[model samples]
Target: MENKQLLEIAEQAKENAYVPYSNFHVGAALITKSGKVYTGCNIECASYGGTNCAERTAIFKAVSEGDKDIEAIAIASDNSSKNEITAPCGICRQVIAEFALDIKIILGYSKGDIKEFKIKDLLPHSFTGNDLI
Candidate 1:
């Protein structure tokens, strides 16, 4: 899908985020190579370590459905300030690298600013599945 449309999906998903802890709502949308899209929102748990980021949630949902060939992902957050924090977390980067290191990651802001990047761009020199053999 186009970046514009992907941003929209991410923004829509952001509305569903369940973040009672930090109040930082985040959303993610994953698009498989077969033209299927899956959306996810950040789910926070009482146990801080159990919290799941929106990016991984979306990718995992796609994987659970037997679709591992993810082509792209879109991420959106409610934060609108331009503070150079429009990026996924380290754990989320590892999760995306496991399936497809070349996947496109689109970052969206609540203020309509968007950025598109490849997984490798965000996490260069990252360890991948092939390295764990």
Candidate 2:
């Protein structure tokens, strides 16, 4: 899928974010190598630690469906700013690295500004399943 299309899906997913505390809505879209797309929104919790990021939500959903070979992922936040780009957190980065070390990560804004980065670029020398082997 095109980056813009993937970003659009992520933006749509952002609307479903359950953020009653921080009010920061984030969305993510993961695209498998086979062209399957999984979209997720940030889900917050009262306990804070129970919160799930948008990226991980999408990745976990894909994994639950037995799709691990992710080709690309797009993330967008509904912060009402088009110039502000948000990257995945440390935990989300690690989770993404587990399945796709070289996956493309697309960070997008509401005004059409987008940036792409490889997973390795976000997490260099990451510890993956290879470390356990």
Candidate 3:
């Protein structure tokens, strides 16, 4: 799927975000190499450390279904002011690198506003399984 389509899916997923604390709603859409799309929304918890980010949620869902090769991923975060394009958090980036180091990452804003980057661009010299080998 195109980046625009993935952004749309992420936007739709944002509506289900359970963020009563920070009120930061985030959504993510991940496309596997096989062309299957999985969407996820941020889920907050009473214990701040227990919160799960949208990107990881989507990635975990895909992984749980036995989809390991992610071709691309789109992330959208909605804010009260200008919805600036936001990249995935540190942990999310690491998790993404674990799956696909060269995956395309699309940071999305309103609708058409987006910025694309390779996973390596976002997380250079990332620690991956190769480090353990």
Candidate 4:
């Protein structure tokens, strides 16, 4: 699917965010190499440490479903700033690296506005399974 379409899915998924604390809504959509799509939204808990980011949620869902070869991921958020593009957290980046080292990362800033990046650009010198050797 096109980046815009993936971003649109993420945008829609943002509505399901359960952010009772920060009230920040985030969403993510990832497309596996098998052409399967997975969507997820940030889910916050009463305990701060229990919160799950939208990117990680989506990645985990795909991985659980046996879709480990992710080709790309799109992330969107209700940041209310045209200049600020939503970015995945460090943990999410590492998780993505674990699955695909160079997947495309699409950041949806607003309707029809997006920035494309590679995993290496977002997280340089990232630690992956190869590092364990």
TM match of model 1 to true structure: 0.92
Q: Better model by lDDT, 2 or 3?
A: 2
Alpha-carbon runs more than 4 Å astray in model 1:
80-85
Clash count, candidate 4 = 0
Worst 10 residues of 2 by lDDT: 77-86
Error of 2 at 46 (Å): 0.6
lDDT of 3 by residue, 66-124 (tens): 99899999888885116578788999999999987899998866455678999999999
Model 4 Cα RMSD, Å? 1.4
Q: Taking the tens digit of each residue's C-alpha lDDT, what string does model 1 give over 7-110?
A: 67887988899999999988889899999999999999999999999999999899999999999998878763442335789999989988877999987664
Root mean square deviation (Cα) for candidate 1? 1.9
Ten-residue segment with the worst summed lDDT in candidate 3? 77-86
- Residues 25-53, candidate 2, lDDT per residue (tens digit)? 99999899999999999999999999999
User: For candidate 4, lDDT tens digit of each residue in 14-116?
Assistant: 8999999999999998999899999999999999899999999998899888889999998998862454687889988888888767899999654656889
Candidate 3 wrongly placed segments (more than 4 Å): 80-83
- Model 3 scores a TM of 0.94
Evaluation by lDDT, superior candidate among 3 and 4: 3
lDDT of 3: 0.88
**Best candidate according to lDDT:** 2
- Per-candidate Cα lDDT values, in order, are 0.85, 0.91, 0.88, 0.87
- List TM-scores for all candidates, in order: 0.92, 0.95, 0.94, 0.94
